[model samples]
Target: MNQVSSSNASLLGATFMLGAGITFAIINVITPIVTWQMGVPSTAVVFWQYVIATVFALPLIWRIGFGALKTRHPVAHEVRAFLSALGVQFFAFGFASGVPVWQMVALSMTGPFFIIAGATIFLGERLTVQRLGATIAGFAGALLVSQIGSEQFTWASILPVLAAACWGTVSVITKYLTRDEAPESLTLYMLVLITPNHFLIGLILGIAVAILPAGALPASLATGFDFMLPGGDALVLILLLGLVTAAAQYFLSLAYKVADATYLQPFDDLKLPLNIIAGWLVLGQVPGILFWPGVLLIIGASLFIMRQDRGRLPTGRSPIPETA
Candidate 1:
């Protein structure tokens, strides 16, 4: 990034940033369609999505070879990979439970707060007053966005927030492991291990679904865990979902390669509005009036954090990796 002039690199990174935001927005909109409208189980949706995504990521893994697997923190890699897989599952389950696309995306923004909190407790990282205040506001914003006491709120609303926490914790561990492990090693470990985590978890869910009494669980919890892919157009949509997931990750990597993470923070925030618009246009999932207050706090707090960390964290070193 330092090799290129600031203006040129920032422009290039912004372009990729836009591309990534667009792709993830597409992902957000398509997910609920596949899980709810199409009747495919969320378990199967997450499983196959990662499998197809791995297929898209194969070329990079091949280029890097098994050498990328060499790491000083194998256990940490496994834990992070598993948590990332779990995060994807929780996000899928949110859609399956009918959380509107916009709301889910909004809740996902709480990740950085979790990362900061986790870093402070687990990594002994400093928690500045500004960061602590931002973290509190971020969670407060999440609570407002969640609309806990409103008739619209459901237990499902927690899933996206949980997903964010999972991914954020993954980022925390990545911060620890990256002290000695290469970034490529982390990516390689994720690509190789995440799908198995998905598969194993899916299998367990399938067994539980089959064996658990019919009325034992809530209606939402009782949704079948399907191992089979959906037929016809649903299959096509899931395939596209995987392809775009890889595309989003690729574009994010490109953006970080060319420009600083702080420089691209504003562009990253675009995902919230992009997903909101996509939900409104594609699914008529308009966010309620309360959504604005929460979203504002989240974006504002994130921008404030980025400003504070400008020279400290540096490029390619942001704790919140979207891919994680």
Candidate 2:
């Protein structure tokens, strides 16, 4: 491809990634609000949330089936992916456990840190000083935004951090495994294989928490769906939310093909501000004063990573190879 074509492709990919970031940010903002409105426990809410995602994955799997599995270790590699996904699911579930929303947003920004650490450990990638310093600064911002000194800390807070580590590992592993596989195949395998594991866990947790001595489960179930014509609006909203999420994932996949990961990743920092906006618009929850500084720090750190990665590339290097 010529320079003009490459630039255009990168621009298109960047646009898609921005869309994905916005959708994810909206999901992050609205999910907790939904859980609170539904009076469902965080875990239950998360379980249902994944159900929507799982539903979205089904059509994709149907579009590409066992034929693609022939190229990869259908069982083992899928299991690895699923396990990583489980960690992410746990993070989603923990989002509601009374932890402040702003704190969750700030701490989760450390995802880049874990991602960088994972690359170093798993892929033997060197950690540049700029990236390392930026990672540390990101966490410092998290601490400030979360007000670690003032708020009570609990195990729940650790889940997002662990999720980031797991996701980071997944990224390296995914890159390794998908060396010769199609993106459609990997996504399908992840959703189909991972869903069962998540479903089983959700079932166990749902039952465990539902059967509690008190009428908590019954109450949640009572308000769960309403199961009537009136609930059509709710169902439509859920489906729409899921569609938005799936669209985001699709765009992210497209972005990967057109732009370097480092270049595209810094754009993900857009999620924080978008989340704050979505929260305020949808749920009337604006971020606190500390959030502004924390967001700036995260953006700065992400930009540093992008710059460091770009610095390593050969001059005039293009992100995508020319077909002809």
Candidate 3:
């Protein structure tokens, strides 16, 4: 592609990614509400979302043919799928546990720092001073969100941080696979592998809840396994959750195809502010005063990293090293 075309494609990819981030933020806000209304466990909700996403992607799989499923890096795909599933579980647990939307979003910002560190340590990418500074600032923001030395500090709050770390690992592995794999294939295989895993776990959790006494299971598991059949509006919202999540995943895959992870990482912070707006508009929940400063630091740090990384690569081209 010519320079103009490349730039346009990158712009398009960035736009899609921003839209995906917004969609994800919306999902983050709504999932808890739906779970509360239906009294269903987080695992059940996650299982259904993945099933719907898998069904939605069936057409793409058919068009691409069975050949798209063939990959020499099966083990890598397996590992990535596992991490992705674990990340989803953590996110669901965190949200269902009643972590505030803004706080959850802030904690999730730790992913970019994890991505930078993973890229440097695992993928042999350079650790620039700007990236190091950004990572430090990002963690500082997370600490602020955690409200250390305050009454809001709870062990349950750590789930989103762990989720962010898992996602960061997934991001680096994804960058590695993208060197030789199609984005569609990576996404398809991940869904194909993780969907069943989530479904099985949900089933197990449901059975455990049915057979075991309430106090026997861990509180998080107990809360996440509190399944109830949805009716009316709750059912509709659950279906929408699946659809939105699927589309967001596809957009993210496309974004990574057009740009390096570093270039795209900053935009992930968009979800924080988006979540804040969503909470205010939909739930009448405004963040505490400390949230504003922390969010601004996170965004400002991300922008600093983005500015430092730009112009190092040509427009619309990925910075990932080519593979054999």
Worst 10 residues of 2 by lDDT: 315-324
Q: Clashing residue pairs, candidate 2?
A: none
Per-residue lDDT tens digits for candidate 3, residues 153-196, read: 77768888898888778878887887888765775677578787
lDDT computed for candidate 1: 0.82
Error in Å for residue 264 of model 1: 1.9
Best by lDDT: 1
For model 2, state the Cα shift of residue 183 in Å: 3.6
Would you list the clashing residue pairs of candidate 1? Answer: none
Q: What TM-score would every model get versus the actual structure?
A: 0.93, 0.77, 0.83
- Of the two candidates 1 and 2, the one with more favorable TM-score, higher being better, is 1
Candidate 2 regions with alpha-carbon error over 4 angstroms: 57-59, 62-65, 71-76, 152-156, 179-182, 203-237, 311-324
Tell me the TM-score of model 3. 0.83
lDDT of each: 0.82, 0.60, 0.72
Q: What TM-score does candidate 2 reach?
A: 0.77
